[model samples]
Target: MSTWTSRAALAGAALALSACTEQETGAAAPREVVVARGAVLVAAPPGYCVDRTALRDAEEGSFALLASCASLDPNADGPSAQPAILTVTVSGRDPETTPPRAEALAAAAPEAVLATRQRGALALVHLGDGGDAVLPGGDPRHWRGATGTGGRVVALALYAPRESPLAGAAGGDLMAALAARIEARAPATVAAAPPQARSGDGLRATLARLFN
Candidate 1:
């Protein structure tokens, strides 16, 4: 859908797994599910939300979908007690959409994990990190995880308040659920095969080839 820029590259690198940044903006546009022709389905958990307008503003030409947990008090002070965020982005495998630097990225990140949607032949590559990892310019207090499959990458960042801590398994389960939902809803014609869940070397090579 759009060319991958440094931000996208960082996000792509996140597919391998940071920061906590408070959103200063007001509530986002009404939350709604987006179903793209490429058989991409993007939605958030019930009670959770996505700022479609803000997300679009963040990256105009990109196919990234960002979802956040609904907040009851937009004016609350300090770190939010909001639920985690889920971001799903798809990079078409065509030469124009896929970038050439993916190979080097894969080489450097050797700890990617492979996952799967519950109902399809697609395999997902995931990289997860707690608040300890540093995101390019994001909040280091938030937990982040990302998965890629069928030329698509889905990242979920769980943002809890300092008072509430989220478990790693929770993030994993959420990612899996989203993957399953995507596979179930994708169109039959969008049959792009996913990468195999192998070691980092193989996975990296596969991703480099698939994206580049």
Candidate 2:
């Protein structure tokens, strides 16, 4: 968990900033990206699409950057439940491949933890003031999660702009969906659905509730 975010921090921020700069980009809706010669499928949630320019892959691993199709390309149209940036990293399952440890990161950078929970094999963390250690200028409150699936461990994060609703609980739900979606795409696992509804709120409202 730490290794994934620690490595992608700078790259994630850059990808987000670049996407924001391109008011008009991407020629088509992206397809599921294959990684590691059929080891993993970078399946993005519905209404979202991968930013191919931000993709990094090797023979057995990959990092994918995703955002609303519209954000990637104005001409592309899709029902994005929340406007935010997302990242997914897939590596061969190993001893180091464990569930996300929000409390662990909190131990190292308590200021970055908003809330954290572990559910069975999956672990998730809500982050605030994580800009220093996570995504700078991102919604201080972002969401990250990790879990093992289909012989590999998947790590993913969701970053919203301050005013975006995804800064709320919906962010966690989204990351979980990303994890589940990846497992569903694995050759061994049965196919599952990818989707979401919507949320209506912003960072200030969330902060008030948290600090109040």
TM-score of each: 0.45, 0.72
Q: Which whole-number lDDT from 0 to 100 does residue 191 have in model 2?
A: 22
Segments in model 1 whose C-alpha atoms lie over 4 Å from true places: 1-6, 9-31, 35-38, 54-62, 65-69, 72-82, 93-164, 183-212
Estimate, for each residue in 19-85, the C-alpha lDDT of model 1 and write its tens digit. Answer: 1134336643333454334445555544544444334321112333333343422543333323544
How does model 2 score by TM-score? 0.72
Point to the candidate with the largest TM-score: 2
Give the lowest summed-lDDT range of ten residues in model 1: 53-62
- For candidate 2, which ten residues in a row score worst on lDDT? 189-198
